[model samples]
Target: MKKILYILVLGGLMSCQKEKETVLKEDIQFLKIKNGLIESSYYENVESIKPIDGFIPNDSTAIRIAETILYKVYGENNIVKQRPYNIALKQDSIWCIQGNLPEGWEGGVFYIELNKNNGKVEKMFHDK
Candidate 1:
């Protein structure tokens, strides 16, 4: 029993140690130059989501980057709409935020605030 308890404790610690992603304010490129995955879509999920982009970022590729961070924080299907807002590459890397969501038919609304300096975001809570 003691050994089992020890293993359980270790597992808990390991699972809780989810590494956070850090996005620099100056290193964000809207388009993926490495794999040439620009103008891609998350057709697997998230429907009715119209294509949205901005100037300087012809395709708002920053959204994909932001979505990656959000997915890490809140497992799949948590972020429903990952849209970019206020995308401007002025001197510093563009700073933007997106909305996330829970499972199906959730009337409740949720939003995620972006922290470009660290490239991570926490779920913003509001009273229903």
Candidate 2:
């Protein structure tokens, strides 16, 4: 009787394992199909999309782009400390962004100059 009980338990465990494997395979196949559909749809519609007027159209756009790069190169905390950034347009097509220090603070800030029309980074440096 004990041997028979052990055989039954082992069989149940094997069946459960097989069920899990089947579910996993189904999930993987579903993900593959969904991914393929999304990719194909994007490619078909991408060419019809209109081009943007300018890569860095405004001051806010320039700031967002600068912050993204700054966060990656410098730590988030370090970059956030230098708020109230100074932004200017040079030659009507270049964005000049510089980080600012708080009152009475004395330290070098990050500076980035890029082309507003094409979104090209012409110069980037952090003052020491």
Candidate 3:
């Protein structure tokens, strides 16, 4: 009888755990759907829903993204050497990130042009 009770308790616990997992999965799915709806609304042209704008909305964010890319392409030391990165938004859709060289510097700095709305790297190169 004790063994049977133990088995039943174990089964109940297992079932509850499974239920919790299912609920968690459902919650995650709901959140994804909700977020998708919000994103879709941004793209829609309806009067109620605002038109889609560029994604990398600000200079700070653009700088961070550009730095990350630069770090990957040109090692940390190289990126550090070029301090004070210049970031600008052009035509309301392009993020232009350029590395600034110190005074009397002759080497080329990193330059990256990315799409603000889609975060796509349109062009990337490091000057010599």
Number of the predicted model whose TM-score against the real structure is largest:
2
Residue-wise lDDT of candidate 3 within 21-91, one digit each (tens)? 99999766644655336445444665543337666778888888888888888998998888788878888
Q: Which stretches of candidate 1 lie over 4 Å from their true place?
A: 1-59, 81-94, 100-106, 115-128
What would the per-residue lDDT of candidate 2 be over residues 69-110, giving only the tens digit for each residue?
A: 988998788788888899999998899999999989988899
Error of 1 at 49 (Å): 35
Top model number, lDDT: 2
Among residues 3 or more apart in sequence or in different chains, the pairs in candidate 2 whose N, CA or C atoms overlap within 3 Å are none
Give lDDT tens digits, candidate 1, residues 1-128.
99999999998877666421223322345334556554354334546533233222432455566556656766546554423233443334344453534346444433444444334343343223
Clashes of each: 1, 0, 1
| Per-residue lDDT of 117 in model 3 | 81
Clashes of 1: 1
Error of 2 at 67 (Å): 0.3
List pairs with backbone clashes in candidate 3: 55-117
Best first by lDDT, ranked: 2, 3, 1
RMSD of 1: 24.0
lDDT assessment of candidate 1: 0.46
**Candidate 2 off by > 4 Å:** 1-52
